[model samples]
Target chain A: MLPVRRSILGLMDRLMSFHRGSLWVGVVLVVIAPLSVALLLSMWRSPFPINEMISLLEDAESSTPGRFFDPTIRSWYRPLFHLTLWGFWNGSGSLLGGLHWFRYLEVGSVLVLLLLFVSYLRPRTGLQAAAALLAVAVMMGMPGFRDNLEIPVLMTLVGMPMALLVWMLLEREHRWWYTPLILALTMTAIGYKEQGLVIAPVVVGAWWMGSPGARRTTTAVVVLAVLAYLAMRFSTRGHWALFEQDVGFLFGELGEDEAAARFGERPWILYGYSALATIGNILFSEPSRGTFVITDHALSGETRPWEWISIVSSTLMTALIAWWGVAILRRDWSADAWSAESRLFVILVLALGASGALGFNYARDRLGGMAVPFYAAASYFAVLSVAERAGAASLKRRATVALVLVMLAGAWQLRAVGTLHDVRLRAASTHRTWITSPNWSRVTFAHRPRYLSIMQTMTPQGTDPARARRPTYPEWFLALIGGG
Target chain B: MPAGNTRILAWLIAMPALLCAVGLPLYESSDVAQPPAMADTFVEALDDRNVEHAYLFIRQGQDPNTLVRFRDDVRTGGREVQVSPLMLAVAGSDDNTAAMLLSFGARMDYPPNRYVVCLAREMGMDGFVDSQMSTASEVECPPPSGAEFPLLAYVD
Candidate 1:
């Protein structure tokens, strides 16, 4: 009969129904298309930093097939992008490869993305959840790396704070191992690339949101970071460090001095401004008079308009986050503040700010718009908007049915167009000539050897008409004729 | 109420069946009709630098002996060379291959990325140049993307 006991019972009922619901699975299945589109477009489009990456992936003498040493000091950004593509490939190998797998991950990313948002709907964008979802869904329908597409797989790198945020929101007691996982990830990011710097603010923000700004938990994390740095230093035994002379030579050799020479010298503030604006402009609109300016993603060649919408949605969501933070800082969170809902809102806001900052800063160069923090925050914004209003049996059936139909259509479009396109079917290529025939193409394209040799033999010839005109050796035909 | 709900449900079920039966079939023909030669992994078609491709293949999980066999079959005329299987991890894991890759090229003295310590550690740089025990070969980019970029196929 106690209020707390009654509340717990009410919560259990919803959780049970959610698990039992049939639509959740359907929802998962349908979002695949959008992701596929995102992947294909990302792949087929011109690669970024191509000259560098081309040598990185190809040159045998320059560390092709694998690197023995990090070639670039900026290893984080380069490796981070590779990992996102890797996740789509690894996670989807059991299923069909290509757009289909891409579609699945894309939809999964969005649905999960929305789930993050919904978890905070009542706390933050309660009234606007529907419009927000619709906007994000429509945005998701666009083809780009930023939307509900390739960004999800970088969950290990960018989503750390959001993951921690969700954990804190649930406030599940007895969480011991989360620290190690987070530390390993942070160290890996650092080890993996400088882009790992993004994890810091995100985790810090998570801490600020969950506890009252900074509990002993955050202090522990800070301590762990110092220890982690020491551990890395000890493990590598100071090998990673360059002498000051080397640093001077590396930069000095570039001939960047005023009296001697340089490649485009600018003040540090100006450099920071340019870099900051490049990130800021990608996310939102802010007029500036300085020589440093930024463009709409449309002008940047890194994104299309639809992708820009993700940046927009995320930016607006970021603005709301700013408002929430200001509210918390100013002690103006409604008189009924400090309640559960308010805490949840604060947690999400903190996560958004921290991740957004990283995407804007450390990863802005190598990843450009593809970084995790910004995209995840945008996804959170969109998802929260849609999920908050799913319950309630009082609505008319026809309207409900119509809504479902639209959602199904939207989900299909969102998944197919967005997720499927983003799929990266990375096939392993360890040089071999055993694959002389067309049968090897399946592996080359990262498809399962889905079509058997027979299927391949039957395939039509290309523009080179003589190829199809000739009788291709069939599997049995080959054995009989060649007598191998 | 039951009749209307059933009708809607029936329509929903029928639509997908229609797509799979017709739409999918139509889509399938356009793609499935393409030749198989177009689908092979990037490294499979090379005859030029057989050893290099073999190196790539063996590192990818193909046995080095088989690559060596493929080498003999191809008849490279040059003296047969035994490739150390341990060379694969020299680039760290395949995902961090750039580091190990740089190391693979280290014999020539490529300018090493100064941050190799932290970078190698981040990549979990396993120092087993030829140890059977190893870090998992993580192909970070999709294999197909690997095909198109850099070298579509490697030569011996």
Candidate 2:
């Protein structure tokens, strides 16, 4: 009877602690939402779909030629949550079930992050921090912390919880097992996608930023982890020469031969422009760069003016993020205490993580033009933070007012549901249009047969230099009719 | 509010008028903004040959990647076949209704088995990638060493 009573008391304490933590998170989630949503509205696509990258893993189960790449350690490194998605898919007899499972996980993870952020915020102006978060959200939309491609069910249930567990070490003393958990998470993130490389450095940096006494030891662990990762990567894939096939990177193969084989001996600038033409693919036009700018095959000509904009923006944006991060970290406010330093660190970390998009220079050709989202998010965060600090007026209120105005002006651009419906309605009309209209080129870009034939054949593989350039119906075709 | 600031602002304002005379045309043309287009025939000609260059022209919203998969259709006994007419489009303001047709002209010896189309319209972008499968025996190719069917004939 006494043991039971004691257990109940302990449970109550933990519950109360958890409740306190969650309240802060809830408020911040509200704060951050407006910003995230605004960003989403402006963005080419909702930046939250790291799920697509995760979906790659689940899809691999079915891809046969792809099977050649999968190995034992690779399987082990995959997040348990991503792995679980396959199971859920099998159980529910539909991939959508697994997808929903992930959505719920994402929603739950947001809540958990809110709790943690709030807990961190608590040492400061408690409710004010919540208001700040709300301001942040309203200003930025949900920052791009989550991947659009990762399998969410296992990710939420296993991956994120594990991440949070490691996060606890940032605030409290490290449990002996925490190292393994962090290593495990990093490895899993990598297995989920190659972009996981971006994560490893941030974490190692985070670990080093902690307590002075532990800094050296943590740094050593980070170094060893990185070394071990390299060793594994080399052992498995290093022996195999990096294939110079102009496959996915429309950025052009930075292959030894091609780099040297340039006619002008400088393809970088040219590739930069070509990458810009491919740039809009990341935002407005397609769901992903995956299918359209299929591979290195997508790019053309020299870097264009707009592409230069992409590069400059991405650079300034990255610099801004790095600045915020350095400023925050330098202040010794590593954890979420109320100190200006702590606030700086929190915003810095958020900015850096969000700015560091999972999809880096997507194709070799496109650094500036192709890499827009990361910078956009970063820029959005910087603007939001500046706005919040600038005055007493709530950013949320302003952004909401702005959003309504924008929607009123261009309701068509803001809604996702409309996009989905447009596709359905136009698809049939397009078919009819194509059947009825003999001149294929006369039809809209959607009706082109070249696009149709490839739909089932294979997804986009970017341009290969060796392959002769394929025929493309020009963009001027738009002007062929009225309103183009 | 400062006197120096006001003078600097006046100078800045004067500079813009000088620039606007030059900037107006560019600004006006840009407002009719669209990604620069390739000569219509260059894109169209490639589509006719079912050549590799044709595939490179796929626009936004179109699946230029899936348009010509190399490893796809190995099972169900299809020989290595190259499908043609890479469809890549830009989903316009009403992405569904505004959805424009753009293609990379790599002539496919075979017709498409399926397509996923996104339409541009007032509401938004929506469409289906209609998937269909056809017999593999119809294609003629020397079988790839590892399999019964020929590997996909890469248009390139």
Residue-level lDDT tens digits of model 2 in A209-292:
553222445546656776787677666653332223232333333443543355235545434433433333333222123233
Q: iRMS of each prediction in angstroms?
A: 14.6, 16.7
The TM-score measured for candidate 1 stands at: 0.41
Model 1 lDDT per residue over B1-111, tens place: 344443443344223223423443355355446653331332332233233343344345553222222233322233343222222222123422232232222221111
Top candidate, metric TM-score = 1
* lDDT tens digits by residue: candidate 1, A1-484: 6999989988998886655442433332233233333333443321112123222222222232233233343322334344434444445552123224444443554455444433433222222323333333433432222322332234332443344343443343425566665556565554443434455654554454454333456437755784666454455443321111111111122112431232234233333443454344333422121111224334556443333333444355445445544544455345533533344455444433443343332122222222333433443343332223223223475456435534433342332332322332110111111122222233232343333332232222111122111123244422221211
lDDT of 1: 0.35
lDDT of 2 by residue, B1-156 (tens): 233432332233223222323443444355436543343442342323322223224432334334432222322143333432232121112122111222232222223422212111111223311111112234443322332321122222
Model 2 chain B worst lDDT window (10 residues): B90-99
Q: First chain TM-score in every candidate?
A: 0.47, 0.45
Lowest-lDDT window of 10 residues in candidate 1 chain A?
A: A242-251
